[model samples]
Target: MRVLVVEDETSLAEVVRRGLTREGFVVDVMHDGQDGLWAATESAYDVIVLDIMLPGLDGYQVIARLREAGVWTPVLMLTAVDGEHDQAEAFNLGADDYLTKPFSFVVLVARLRALIRRGAPERPVVLTNGSLSLDPVRRRVLRHGSEIALTPKEFALLTFLMMHAGEVVTKATILDAVWDPAYDGDVNIVEVYVGYLRRKIDTPFAEASIETVRGVGYRLLEAGPAGPAGPAGPAEPAEPAEPA
Candidate 1:
């Protein structure tokens, strides 16, 4: 299989190149993020190994741009930083797998092989409800052509709701999906975030795309809301009072 390794460390890149060549895989190595992005975009490869910190566009930007430009090659990201948020951001930005620095070569080979086997299946790539659009790979959210900034948690919550658009998702389900499964915090936190979403995505535009189902949870309308401030639009059911 063909693999592209984009690591800024020349020694590490050469070592990986040699090791993978010995493992009976064709490997092409690039030493900077810009060169790496160009190679991956300009060539067809089965998979790519990308590093997070690099001169000229970083690994995150490279992956996001690749996905944005319709290059779906599976990417395994390398990062020395071992924070959960970093890993989360990597996946959120279209990384297929992640390996921290000082990783096991054996594990790396195994992961690469696994990604090759999985191949790239073309998913929707963007989630949308009416005029609201969310690009998971780019970590961007847009409403009526205007970008709406969102915190990671809020973005995640909105993604979940859009995924289940038109369905009434319970607070338990929202908590489990958006927050950690073992989250022990108050479930009402979902309500607070939902309110936050409405303020940004709904209220400002005089839209009611997110509907509160009394005694249940919430639902994101599949049709989404009307254009921003265009008209009173159709009347939506009154939202139940948010928890105190």
Candidate 2:
């Protein structure tokens, strides 16, 4: 295993380096946060042992920047502050594991092992097309970075379209996916919600993200310049269905 230790305490850092090396691990030591962050990003290490207090960027900043840059290497924070808030902040900023100062070498090694075994959890990605963004897990929608309120059904319908952006989705297909299988209500509900989505997600912004294909269905335009809203004269008509 390869490890990078970012503690500034010379004696403590040396002890950890020697100990990990004796355990058959390749170790790289950095005495400050700037160098630590640079090395962590520039090198591929199995795990990182980070100290919260250090010169230049702190542990929180280093990890935050790393994550912002989409680097997912596992990180274990080593810090003297054991306060609950500090720990919470570390986690909120994306530290994989946190160990307070005065920690035992054996315990540290074990924690590192556990983190490696668990691996990095896949980060959820917010779906985006143009100014619109949807976080399915958080159930949040943003347009141009501003939150847009959506009813549950509206959210479901919009999500379906966004998921299949750029494709001609039939009204029947949408009804089957977004509404209950047993739904025997008006099929025009799909049109109504599409209108609602356009009003909120497109109209005010002068975007025609949802395009109607008269006698067919609709499509959520892929991100970029959009043409006027209305029927995209039949190229491939959606499989015929009872009029919505």
Full-model lDDT for every candidate: 0.82, 0.78
lDDT of 1 by residue, 154-240 (tens): 787887787788799999878755664335898988888887788778776666777778789888877735443223334544445
How far in Å is the alpha carbon of 53 misplaced in model 2? 0.4
TM-score list, all predictions: 0.54, 0.54
Error of 1 at 97 (Å): 0.5
Best by the lDDT measure: 1
Task: Tally clashing residue pairs in candidate 1.
Answer: 0
In model 1, pairs of residues that clash are none
Candidate 2: pairs in clash: none
Please, what are the lDDT tens digits per residue for candidate 2 over residues 1-244? 8899998899999999999999888999999877887787678788899999988768887787566444567899988989999999998988889998899989998998887787765554777777788776567898777899887677777777777889999998887666543469988778777777766776576666787877899888786532333333323323333233
Query: What RMSD does model 2 have?
Result: 17.4
Kindly give the number of clashing pairs for every candidate. 0, 0
Model 2: lDDT equals 0.78
Q: Give the TM-score of candidate 2.
A: 0.54
